[model samples]
Target: MAGAALAGLRIVVSAGPTYEDIDPVRFIGNRSSGKMGFAIAAAAARRGADVVLVAGPVALPTPDGVHRVDVRSAAQMHDAVFAQLPADIYIAAAAVADFTPRQVAPGKIKKRDGEDGLTLELVRTRDILAEVAVDPRRPRLLVGFAAETGDVETYARGKLAKKKLDLIAANRVGVEGSGFESDDNALAVYWNGGERALGPAPKTELAERLLDLVAERLRA
Candidate 1:
């Protein structure tokens, strides 16, 4: 692969898991360790692209030469990405929660002695990728992740069209040691005219391969 294939390009990437607060002491979140997105950011920077990484809560060190913005919630992630928009590429790798508590409790709720059960109302979160895809200043290439367990290709293709993304990276979630919070990953990439399998390698190798494919698409 040419090291300068993505030279001078600007890339924006979102990584990690968004937290939705239920109370001051409790929140809803996923198990994304942010390894994949961080790997992508590092790969893009290595390819000489200016990278802006909008990250959620994670312990990964900042990749050399990549600007990172840390955020906690899905809404914050969405805002951060758009604030630094107009990039050449946008990759939505964060495992964003689909719903959040309708209202965050001011304080922890006390358990009722006689109550048999409790119910909580939830609301759909803003579809960050969909929002960004429809923006007038959206990036030239938009990539989304469809973390599905079954019917991988069908769901990925659907998301590609529904989100109006240039490409979608599909992976199986909920399998034993396969998806969320895993260090090694495999991807089935789908686009308008083609699809390809990426890997079961280390995150860094997969990132490099994915970047190469992105560069090829951009050049074409």
Candidate 2:
């Protein structure tokens, strides 16, 4: 670790799927397993960075030499990340709920007998990645993640610029054997005027390669 590329740096990573509660027991969430982000945190820690991982609800064990903060909702994740403030890099990898029920039921929403259907009104959650950009103490390298089914590069690049991100890792979800919950993954990482492909391997390996790129860019 003494000779590692990320030595002496501070990196923050967000992971998992945030649960938006519709009731005490029911919540809206995604299928994110947090493998990619957790892998990145572990890799960065191995490379000697002081890593702070703001993780949502996932069953994974905490990686060695990393500080972990657990959270359950998008709003909670948002608070945790910002409270940590001023990292050398920020990896926004959580698959946070885009929207949540407009108002949570005070109790369990009981099914009406013979009712054909039920309706749920939802409202957009705050864009956590975008919110980080306006911080006066924003990280030096702000990276975002894009999971799309089509036009991967186009959408990723758009978000990279739109969110004022320094880099973004994009992948297509709903494909067999990868994305979301899979341990195996790949990424097309885009930064200003450049890009790189990392895997089709274990999420851990991809994270190392991605961070290698990050180290290179940091040096540049």
Candidate 3:
């Protein structure tokens, strides 16, 4: 990999899982550990890019020389990302919540004495990747992630077109030690003319390889 592959470029990354509030103390969230996105941010910084990392609730520390914006929900993440604006590259690595509670109860929901169960309403959250792709001043390079269980390539290709992404990294979820909150990952990266399978290595190594591909695409 070229040490200065992305020198002087600006990159924006979205990471982690958005939490939708059910009540003041309760929420619905995913199992994203933010490892991949954080690693990507670090790798990009290492490549000499000015990086802005819009992240959800995660316990990781900020990478050196990278700007970090902490957010809680999908809406907040969207607002933060767009507020930065006019980035050279955009990587939507976040496993954003597809839906959020229709309304958050002002107070904690208590079980009724006679009620057997309670129903919570949910509404679709904005597609962050699609939003960025459709922007009039969208980034020169846009990437998205598809965490799928079966037919990973097919589903990733569909999403690539649907979101108008330059590339999509597809991976299987729910496999033992493979996805969501896992520290180690493997990816099937798909682009316009070809695809590549990255290792089941440490997240940091995979991140560097992925950034190398992005830099190559930018050059091409």
Weakest 10 consecutive residues, lDDT, candidate 2? Answer: 1-10
Residue 1 in model 3: shift from native, Å?
A: 5.6
Q: Candidates' TM-scores?
A: 0.97, 0.96, 0.97
In model 2, the clashing pairs are: none
Candidate structures ordered by TM-score, highest first: 3, 1, 2
lDDT by residue for model 1 (129-212), tens: 999999999898899998987999998999999989998999998876567778888999999989999987778898999998
Judged by TM-score, which candidate is best?
3
Query: Pairing residues by index, what is the TM-score of model 1?
Result: 0.97
For each of the candidates, the C-alpha root-mean-square deviation to the true structure, in angstroms, is: 1.1, 1.5, 1.0
TM-score of 3: 0.97
Error of 1 at 76 (Å): 0.7
Ranking by lDDT: 3, 1, 2
lDDT of 2: 0.90
Off by over 4 Å in 2: 1-3
